[model samples]
Target: MSSNRKTLWQIFRAPLLLGLLSLTGLIGALVGDGLFDLISWATLGSALAVIAWYWAKPTV
Candidate 1:
């Protein structure tokens, strides 16, 4: 196999993490107020930041 080929973990890791983070944010926002509200916003905002970073990145 070529060294350039990505492992399954490498391919799936980011997407899996983003999905879990997004789920946590949604649930947090739904289940409480005050501190939970802040936690949910931070979690969700980080996810959005990651997305924006990817969207604005320069392509090879």
Candidate 2:
């Protein structure tokens, strides 16, 4: 039998990064207009894409 071990950082890194990006998007939406608004939309869209991708995955 083989067992693979994962570290805390490995597990949390993606979620933390997504959280940071989403937070930045929220702040950008609040802090400015024009380019910042566009950036915020793009970042939020990327986050939603990731969520949809994960949600569509097959589970066993």
By lDDT, the best candidate is 2
TM-score result, candidate 2: 0.81
lDDT of 1 by residue, 1-60 (tens): 356989899999998988888788899988999999998898878888998998999976
lDDT of 1: 0.87
**Model 2 Cα displacement at 47 (Å)?**
1.8
List pairs with backbone clashes in candidate 2. Answer: none
Write candidate 2's Cα lDDT for 9-60 as tens digits.
9789998998888988999989999999998998878899998998998865
Candidate 2 segments exceeding 4 Å error: 1-3, 58-60
* lDDT at position 41, candidate 2: 95
Residue 23 of model 1 has an lDDT of: 84
What is the Å distance of residue 49 in model 1 from its true position? 0.6
Model 2 scores a C-alpha lDDT of: 0.88
